[model samples]
Target: MSELTAFLSSNVVFGVWGGLVGLSLLVLAVDLHQKNAHLSPMMKFVWALTVLYSGPIGLGIYFYAGRKEIAHDSIWRRGFRSVAHCYSGCGMGEVLGVILTVGLLSLGNLWVALASFSLAYVFGFGLTMGPLMQEGETFSDAFNDALYSETPSITVMEVVAIGADLLLAGSAHMGQTLFWGALIFSLSLGLFAAYPVNVLLIKWGVKEGMMNPKHTPGNAAPQTA
Candidate 1:
């Protein structure tokens, strides 16, 4: 009986860490698909969950379902190149951000680390796609841009959320409290950090004359007089 209890406890701890690692990877992957890309949000979500829960099986699913196909024809080469470049840049940014944040949190406390990560994700989703819309850069684009450009901000906010979670986790030592508190802190800080960066990106897009406000059917641009 004691052995069984110890095993269960160990599993719970492992599960918590696994969940955080999985979630961070999932968020990074989703952020790679730009808003206007030929992928659906639902599809991204499924991929994220798969990566989180299933490990190797999830990676196989990603290669099959999440990987984008590029056309090699000369006419489409430039566009494809642009898309590839954008995604690559986004991927690098997300990787760095997630690594730094997770590393710092891991050093402090495991629960706090996981909570910070969860909050980062929740807040990232809300800030990147919620109210502001910010010129429809997709959740992926916004997140990548934020991660890439605002590394310091992300690191700081994540640390703050982790610290807060640690305090709450220590006090209550209750699963529900830790989870909810982490979620709330992550969401709040994520929004606070992401919103301004999104706005800046929007402003930059507008200045660069790349702001596309409408998505015409069939993904075609309407002719103007």
Candidate 2:
């Protein structure tokens, strides 16, 4: 843990990397708002939030893999978009749960993990249901869709995040830089862990994997499944 702490404390290197990430996030967010207004709000939010943690790599992927110019994306690209969508909501909720439980409340690891999982499910389901609701689906129907589509990926992400947190011993106070660093690292691992689950979900027709401009209420792109 001490070694990890020392590594993260390398201010010169971390500062440069952090600056690049911050710039990438800002550029992506602005581009989404100004140029990609036809995209669903959720997707715009996903790309920006993905860049927030994944940094330049996320930025590169967004430019190379997420653009709509290709017209028909491969299954892998579609799967990545699904995972990014899931990660945006689940990751944010997990971070908030950690802040509330561990940072503010100073709870034990088990309680923190539980609270994080609970919040992750809440955000994950809410994000998934939002687009369906926009398409005039009833609340119950949207809820069912979200439950079926989001549960497995969110579960895998939360489990991986918890494991990463434990392995890294990253339950520091919120005021500390280590807190954010640890959360970022753990959540990134969670994102990677959930990717295969999302691909499977796409393959099984349990989740939509298309990414296209929003010409209609729901996603306009065809589902890969």
Best model number under TM-score: 2
TM-score of each: 0.31, 0.86
Residue-level lDDT of model 1, residues 21-128, one tens digit each, is: 576676546544443244444334534543443344445534432444322222123222222222222223333333444444333356445644555445544433
Name the runs in model 1 displaced over 4 angstroms: 1-153, 170-174, 201-213, 216-225
The 10 consecutive residues of candidate 2 with the worst lDDT sum are 212-221
Query: Which candidate gets the maximum lDDT versus the true structure?
Result: 2
How many clashing pairs per prediction, in order?
2, 0
Query: After best superposition, candidate 1 residue 45: deviation in angstroms?
Result: 4.2
lDDT of candidates 1 onward, in order: 0.40, 0.79
